[model samples]
Target: MLARRLLIFSRQFVNFTPVIRRQFADSASQTKTVKFISGNKEFIGKGKVGDTLLDVVVNNDLDLDGFGACEGTLACCTCHVILNEKHFEREDRTNPAGEEELDLLDLAPEVSDRSRLGCQIKIMEDDPEVIEVRVPSVTKDQRSA
Candidate 1:
C-alpha cells in the first residue's frame, strides 16, 4: 500500500514540474537588446537575460570577426568587446568578469579600460540600460592559432 501511494505522489510531482519550469524559463528568456559596433559597421542584437554577449552575437548572426573563438570558454580572448565603462562596472552586472577573464584580456590586442570577455558578461533581468559594445577591428587568439 505504501509503495502504491509513493508512486502516485511521484507521478503528480512529475506532472507539475513542467509548469514550474515554464515560469522560470519565461523570466530567463526575456529579450534584451544590445548595440554592437564593429569597425565601421553597427549591429543590433537581441539576447536573453541569462545569455552571454557572445551568445547574442552568434544568435543574431552579427558579423563580428573571430568572436567566440573558444566557444564561450575563458581559454581565449577572441570574444573581447569594449563596453561602456559605466555599464561594465555596474554594481548589478550579472556574471561580471572573473579573475580568469581579466587574465585573458591582458593577452588580447587593443586592450582598453573598457575591454571585457563577452563570454563572462551576462545580461541582467532588471537592467533597463541598453548596452553599447565595441568590437575590436583585429582579434587574434594565439592559443587557438
Candidate 2:
C-alpha cells in the first residue's frame, strides 16, 4: 500500500541520517589546522590526524615548494620542517626520532635541534596543540631536480 511504502522510506531516511552525520563528524574530528611559515608568508593547512606533516602541506596545496620530495617515505629529506619548540616538547609526540630521521636531518641545510622530517611528525588527533612548521626558503634537490 502507499502508506506502507511511505513508512519504509521514512525509516530508511531516519537510519541514513545518523550514518551521514557520523561520516561528517568523523572526518571533521580527524582534521586539525596546522601552520606553515616561510619567509614572510604564513600558510595554514588542514590535515587529518595520523597523517604526516608533509601530507598536510601537500594535501592543502600550501605555498611550500618542493616539499616532501620523497612522499614521506623517509628516503629523502626534502620535507625537512622546523617544528615549533612548544609543539615539539609536547609529551604526546609520537616518538623520538629514529636514526634514519636524524641522519637525514643532518643533511638538511641549517639543521637545528628542533629540525625534523615533515614525514616523521604524525599530527595527533587528541592533542590540543596547534601545529607550527617552518619551511626553509632553501633545501639542499632542493626541488626534486
Candidate 3:
C-alpha cells in the first residue's frame, strides 16, 4: 500500500513538471520584443534583430531630451530610464550595471528599482519581442539647490 501511494505521488509530480517548464519558457519568449513608452509616446524596439535600442533611439531621433547630453556614452546619467517590470526581468542578456553605472544612476532624479542606463542595454540575438522603458524628466543635478 505504501509503495502504491508513493508511486501515485511521483506520477503527479512528474506530470506537473512540464507545465512548470512551459510557463517559464513562455515568460522568457514573451520578453524578447521591447516596447518603450514615455508620456504619450510609444515606441517599439525590435529585439533579436541586430539593432540596439540606442540605434533605434538615435535613428528615430526620439523626442527624449537626455540623449544629447550623453552622446550615447555611458559617462553621464542623462540617459537614465526606468525599465518596465517585464523588461527588467528579462534583462539578463545585458550586462549588469558596473560601479560607475550605479554611481551615475545615483545622480539621476526619479531613480527607482527599475533604473537602467540606456546606453548599457544592448539588443540580443535571441531576445524577446519587446521590452519597455520610461524616461524620467529630471536628472539629480537638474533638481539641485
Candidate 4:
C-alpha cells in the first residue's frame, strides 16, 4: 500500500513539473521594455506589458505639451503627437478616436492620419523593438492660454 501511494505521488509530481515550468516560461516571455525617441531625444523605459505611452512620458518628463493642461485626462488634446511609422505599427490595434478626442484634435494645428493624443495611447510592449513617437507643438488653445 505504501509503495502504491508513493507511485501515485510520483505521478502527480511529474504532472505538476511541466505546469510549473510553463508558468515561468510564460512570465519570462511576457517581460517587455519600452524606448521612446522624439527628434533629438531618446529614452528607454523598463515597463511591463500593459504600460501606457503617457505613463512612460509622464515618468520620463518627455517635454510633451497639454500634459500640464489636461493632467492626462484625455480632456484636452494638448498632448497631441505624431507616432513614428515604426512605433505606429507596434500598437496592437488603432484605438478608435472618440468624438471628444476628435474635436480636441481639430484644435490641434497639424492633425494628420498619424495624429494621436498622447494620453490616449497605451503602449503594448510585446514587440522586440523599441517604439518611437514625436510630440508636436501645443494645441491652438493651449498655446494661446
Candidate 5:
C-alpha cells in the first residue's frame, strides 16, 4: 500500500512540474518594456501584461511633460502618443480604438494617422518585448483652457 501511495504521489509531482515551469515562462513573456520619447529625451518603462501605456509611465515616473493630465479618464487628449505603422497596425488589429477615443484624438494637437491614446493602449502578451511611443512636442488641453 505504501509503495502504491508513493507511486501516485510521484506521478502527481511529475505532472505538476511542467505546469510550474510553463507558468514561469508565461509570466516572463508577459512583462513588456516600453520606450517613450518626448522631444529629444527618451525614457524607458516596464509593465506587465494588461497594463496601459499610461500605467507604465506613471509607475516608472517617466516625467513626460503634460502627460496623463486627465488621469486616463479618456476625457482629454493629454495621453496622446504616436506609434509607427507596424506597431500601430498590430495594436489596432488586436484592440481597435473606440469611437470615443478616436473623437478625442481629433481634438488633440499634432494628431497623426499613427496616433493613439496612451490610456487606451494596453500591453498584450504577444506584443513585442520593447514598444516605442512618441509624445508630441506640444500638447493642447482644451478642457482646462
Candidate 6:
C-alpha cells in the first residue's frame, strides 16, 4: 500500500508540474528579421528562447504561402526552408535534423545541403538575432484527401 501511494504521488507531481515559460525582449526593441530569398521581402519576428522558426514566421504574418500547412505537426514538409550556411551549422544551436527530419527533407522541393524543416528549428537563447530563411521557389501540392 505504501509503495503504491508513493508512486501515485510521484506521478501526480510529474503531471501537475507547470511548464516554464521562456521570456524574450519586446519585439519592438529586439526585432528579428526573417528574410525571404525569393521575394527579397523581410518580416520581423520576435522569438523567445524556445520559439520555433515556424512560430516566429506565423506569429509575424510574414505572408509566406504554403508555410505551416501542417501546423508544425511534422505530417508534411510545408515549412521546409533552406538556412544560410552560416546559421545552418551553428555550433550553439541545440536543434539538429534527426533521421526522420532528414527523410522528410527529401520530400521538400529543391532540397539542399542546408535544407531543414522550419518547425524543427527552435530559437535557443544564444541563436542569432537575424535568421535568413529561403523558401523554395516551387512547392509540391501535397494536399491529401
TM-score top scorer: 5
Give candidate 4 misplaced runs (Cα > 4 Å).
1-25, 28-39, 43-46, 63-68, 86-94, 138-145
Error of 4 at 141 (Å): 20
User: Which digits, one per residue and each the tens of the lDDT, describe model 3 over residues 10-113?
Assistant: 64355446545665666642224556676667766544333446655776666664563755445687777788676666663345666767888998888898
* Tens digits of per-residue lDDT for model 1, 1-145: 6774575446435534654466497754577798889777888899866567899999999878578987865679999988876777772254356576789999988999889988766666555657788988855577886
Q: Tell me model 5's lDDT, rounded to 2 decimals.
A: 0.81
**Which candidate's lDDT is highest?**
5
Pairs that clash in candidate 6: none
In order, the Cα lDDT scores of the candidates are: 0.74, 0.72, 0.62, 0.59, 0.81, 0.67
Superposed model 2: Cα runs more than 4 Å off: 1-28, 91-93, 139-145
Candidate 2 lDDT over 1-145, as tens digits, reads 5774575456446544654566577766456788888767899988766666888889899877788886766667888878777767762253567676788888988787888888767676554557778877753564676
Residues 98-135 of candidate 6: C-alpha lDDT, one tens digit per residue: 67678788888788888898887766545567666788
Give lDDT tens digits, candidate 4, residues 77-98.
7677677665554532544565
Q: Is candidate 3 or candidate 5 better by lDDT?
A: 5
Q: What range of 10 consecutive residues in model 6 has the weakest lDDT sum?
A: 15-24
lDDT order, best first, reads 5, 1, 2, 6, 3, 4
The better candidate by lDDT, 4 or 6, is: 6
Candidate 5: stretches off by over 4 Å: 1-29, 139-145
Residue 33, model 3, lDDT: 53
RMSD of 4: 14.6
Clashing pairs in 1: none
Error of 5 at 65 (Å): 3.5
Candidate 3, residue 13: Cα displacement in angstroms equals 44
* Residue-level lDDT for 136 in candidate 6: 78
- Predicted structure 1: clash tally: 0
CA lDDT, candidate 6, residue 102: 80
